[model samples]
Structure formats: structure tokens, C-alpha cells
Target: MRGPVRWVLWDVKDTLLKVRRSVGEQYCSEASRLGLELPPSQVEAAFKQAYRRQSKLYPNYGTAQGLGGHRWWVAVVKDTFSQCGVKDGATLEKLSYNLYHNFKNAENWEVFPDSERTLRSCTDMGLKLGVVSNFDNRLEGILRACGLLSHFSFLVTSEGAKVAKPDAAIFHQALQRCGDPASSVAHVGDHYVNDYLTARSLGLLGLLLDREGSTLHLDDVPARHRLSSLDELPALLQKRAEGG
Candidate 1:
């Protein structure tokens, strides 16, 4: 028989907190501050293109290219600003520095309404919590700003693990940190491939937080492993605790 789950691992981004201002919106704001004028629509379009290109080429947030956290982001920032019509090298560097640093602001993100109560419920149930994310260490700061950092006992990042999700190394690293049997842990996140399938394949219970029913039609996702909101988590796990 499987042991009681002792740990609940989480993913950030669309799971706990979401960005209030998108990258394009922030880029336009920064450009205006630096006296680089461009139409908002143009800036937004450019950012989308740049983001898609960089993401496809480097995937895994540029870690696949052997770029460190900041270096990886620097490429994206450069590509974004360049596409937005700022041609001066000096201006690009300045914009990159300010834009990257400004994103760390707590005001730029909003936590899901059910996040706190759900976390507390897990804590009350005696389940240890930690984060397993593809993000860099800046995640700690963001979580702290959102008041969710304290809820986690530990956090493992792609930068720290030397690999990103869907790859198994990062999850294994988190498992080692929790020091529990894989069957006695659950991982929850928004991504179907990165969060659910990856963890489940490793013998960990994986649930997809499908806030929008985006993947509800996929035949591969079991209904029991899907959630529309975090508020559903404690009760679902309670059933598991009861051997349901």
C-alpha cells in the first residue's frame, strides 16, 4: 500500500501567482521611461514575436543554451527591446537592466484567490510543502512578495537543478529534498506536460490545475487528476488520506 502523502510540491507562474502586467505591457512602459517612443500595439506585437522566437530556439527558458539565469533573460530582453524599435546598443543595455529588475516588484503580480487558503489547509493536514519550478531563484523573491514563500519548506529551481521540467532531474532533486517515497508526494501545477505527466511518470501523484478547462478534452488526463481551483486540493487529498 502507498504511504500517506507527506509532501505537496508546487509550481509557480500560472499555478500560484500570475503576472498582472504582461511582458509587452511592461516593455512599452519601460521604453517610454527611457524616451524611446513606439506605438503600444507595435511594442506588444514585437514582444510576442521575440518571445516566441527565443522560446522556440532556447526552450526551457534558455537553460538549454547553457545560459545562466540572468544571461538567458538578457538575451530575451535584448531581443524584445530590439524588436520594439530601440536601436541604440546603450539604450538596449539600460532598458534590459531596468526592465529585468523591475519585474521583481510584488505589485506586478497577483495571487490566485484560493492560493493562501489551500496552502494553509495543506499545512494543517501535516503535509510539508515545497516548490518545484522551471523558474530561476528570483522565484523566491516573487513568492515572498506574494506572501507565499513562507508556506514552502524548500524550493528547487531549474537554475539550481541544472535542468527544467518534463526532464525529471528537477523533480528528482525536489524529491531528494523532501526525502519521502515518491508515492507519498503530490505535485500540482498548471502545465499538463511539465507538471502532471512528468510527475506522474515518476511515481508521484500529479494534478493539473486547469483553471480554464483548457485541457478538459484531452483523453489522456484522468478526471481525478484535474482541478479547476486550488480550493479543491485539500478535499481531494483528504480522500487520498482516507484511502479513496
Candidate 2:
């Protein structure tokens, strides 16, 4: 059946792939190898603190092309380790590089159970697909390694767009590449602000894939726009087409 959505834009990471290891767990492992004995929980806490600080310091950081991406992550890693009591400059540098490099491998991630089937079904229904992500250039390598790069015709990363979601620039860039009207596009992502509301504000259908059903109390999002998984997507699109 025909659908109102002509294009489906995806958000990578938790939306499509579940990162098998937490960043803190991975960082703690790396630190242990370097003789640092930080608690995993402490490392996780530090990582979050550092991440928030870094994000503020460098809004739309890693999405930039070239060395800016590398530098941005290096700063984050440095701050993360700093929080864990690793105060040496050279050690922080080595750890940051290794962590960044390690994430390029697909083994560290797992595709969501409904991801492939949903992508295939959408493609079969003639809807074009793309990705709009706040991630950096490493996303392409990670997606290709995970066997998902081919499913998307294009991806606009924060590095590539010079901006991240919750900002209209990235969405506009994706729309330009897909060459579709905003009304014909729907973006599926886990973040209520970055993924759902931002796309909706831009005139695209923004569906929240609330796999954890964590935000039921939020009154701003309609029940119809909330999805537990991509499995319900095609049926929902059909309903939208029928003006439900």
C-alpha cells in the first residue's frame, strides 16, 4: 500500500545499534591495561561528567571533518581519564587514540533486532533511506562494518554538516540530499528532542522509538508518534497514509 512517508531518515547508535559495551566499561578496560585501577562505575560517572563538559566546550564537535573530529574526541577522552585520576599528558593521549581507534570495529556493536527487517521492508515499499546523526565520520566505517551502510543512500553527520540535531541545519542538509519535501520525510530516533521534536518542528514526521518506554510521562509527544520498535513502523506509516 502507498504511504505518506517517501523517505526515512535514521539516527544511528541506540536507535539502530545497541553499543555492546558502555564507553566507561571500554575506557576502564583500556585504563586497566595501562595500570590504572579505576572502578568501572567511577569511570562511567567520570565519562558522563567529562562528556557533558566537553559537549558544552565544543558543541557540534566531532562532526567536523579532518583533524577537528580527532581533536574533539581526544579532548573528551583526556577529560574522561582526567576524571579517573590519570593526570599524565602522554598517557591520556595514548588512551584517547586507542579508544577512538577501537570504536571503528563493528564487533563492539550489535544491530537492533528489528533494524534490518524494517529497513528491507521500507525499501521494498519504495521509501528512500538516509541517516542524520550527531556522530562523527567514524559512523560511516562503523555502519559499513556492521553491514548497514549499503541500506542508506546517504548520511549527514555532525562533522559533515558542521552542526548537530536539535539544530535545523543538519536536518536541512539531509532533506537537500534526499531531495524530498519535509512533509514526505519521517525521522526515527531515540532522542525526544534531537530526533522527534526537531524533525517535527522542521515539518517532517518525527517518530520516537522509545524501546524502553521511558518517556510515557512526557505530554508533548503524541502516543501515535511513539514506537517501541521499528517492527510497528510500516503499519504506522500505512495508518498515516490513510489519515488516521
Candidate 3:
């Protein structure tokens, strides 16, 4: 039989918190401050394109290529604005730099309504919490700024661990830190592959947080393993503890 969950690993982005404004809106707002006029829709489309290209070119913040997180993001921001027809190099540099630092602060992010209550419930249940995110080193500061850092026992980032999700190494790093068996831990995140399947493959209970029912058509995701919000978590754990 599986052991009762003693530890819970969380995914930060989209799961616990998200940007206060859409990337396009934020980018356009920043660009406007630098005297560039661009529609939010156009910037958003360009951002999607630039982000895809950057991810393809420099996967996982380009750590292997030595670009590192900051430079990788700077390149993405530059490409995003460049695609939107901003030709001034100084403007691109200033915009990218501003955006990079802007996201590091709490004003740029908002915690999901269900996040803190669920976290507190988990803590009350005696479960140890830790973060396993594909984010960079700025995560601790961001979490701290949001007043959520104290809830976690430890924070592991792709930049710090040198590994990202969908790869088991980062999860292993978190497991090592918690010193718990995979069967005794549960990982929750919004991605079907990165959060659920990957963790399940490593023998940890994987809970997919499908807030929008995006994965409802997937036969691989059953009702028992999927959550529409973090609010469902504590009850699910209670059920699992009761061998349901």
C-alpha cells in the first residue's frame, strides 16, 4: 500500500500565483513608457511567437549554453519588442531590463484565491511543503514579496537545481531535500505532462490542477487525479489517506 503523504511539492507559476497582467499588456505598458506605441493584441501575438522561438532555441533558460536565466529572459523580451517593430536598441535594452526587474516584485504578481487557504490547510494537516518550480533564482524573492515564502520548508528552482520539470532530476532534487520516499509525497501543478505524468512516472502521487478543464478529454487523466482548484486538494488527500 502507498504511504500517507508526508510532503507536498508545489509548482509555482499558474499553480500558486500568476502575473498580475497579461504579458502583452505588461510589455506594451512598459514600451509605452519608453515612447513606443503598440496595441496590446499585437504585442501579445509577438510575445507568443518570440517566446516559442526563445524556448526552442534556449530551452531551460539556456543553462547549458551559458546564457543563464537573466540573459535568456532579456533575449526573449528583446525579441518580443523587436517583433513588434521596436527598432531602437537602447529602447529594447531598457524595456527588457525593466521587465526583468519588474516581474521580481510582488506588484507584478497575484496569488490565486485558493492558493493560500489550501496551503494553510495542508500545513494544518501536518504536511511539509516545498516548492519545485521551473523558475529562476528570483523565485524566493517573488514568493517572499507575496508573503508565501514562509509557508514552504524549502524552495527548488530550475536555475538553482540546474534541471527543469518534465525531467525527473529536479523532482529528485526536491525529494532529496525532503528526505521522503516518492510514494510518500505528492506533486501538484497545472501542466499535464510536466506536473502530473512526470511525477507519477517517478512513483510520486501526481495531482493535475486543471482549473479550466483543458485536459478533460484526456483518458489518461482520471477524476481522482485531477483538481479544478487548489481548494480540492486537502479533501482529496483526506480521501486518499482513508484509502478511497
Highest TM-score model number: 3
Q: List the residue pairs that clash in candidate 2.
A: 63-158, 63-159, 64-159
List clashing residue pairs in candidate 1.
none
Evaluated at residue 227, the lDDT of candidate 2 is 95
Q: Count the backbone clashes (under 3 Å) in each candidate.
A: 0, 3, 0
lDDT of 1: 0.87
Question: Residue 13 in model 3: shift from native, Å?
Answer: 1.1
lDDT of each: 0.87, 0.88, 0.93
Predicted candidate 3 versus true structure: per-residue lDDT over 1-244, tens digit per residue: 8979999999999999999999889888888888888999999999999889988998888888888889999999999888878889988899999999989889899999999999999999999999999998889999999989999999999988888989999999999999989999999999989999999999999999999999999998889999998999999998888888
Better of 1 and 2 by TM-score: 1
Residue 69 displacement (Å), model 3: 0.8
Give the TM-score ranking, best first. 3, 1, 2
Q: Tell me how far the alpha carbon of residue 167 in candidate 1 is from the true structure, in angstroms, after superposition.
A: 0.3
Displacement of residue 46 (Cα, Å) in model 3 is: 1.6
Candidate 1: tens digits of C-alpha lDDT, residues 81-143:
787666899988998888777778788898999999999999999999999998876888888
Q: Per-prediction RMSD in angstroms? A: 1.6, 2.5, 1.3
Alpha-carbon shift of residue 58 in model 2 (angstroms):
1.4
Q: Is candidate 1 or candidate 2 better by lDDT?
A: 2
lDDT tens digits, residue span 1-244, model 2 = 3248899999998999978888778888888888888888888998898889877766777443334677888988998888778899999989999888888888789899899999999888888999999898889999989999999999899887888888998999999998878989999999989999899999999999999989898999989899998999988887777788
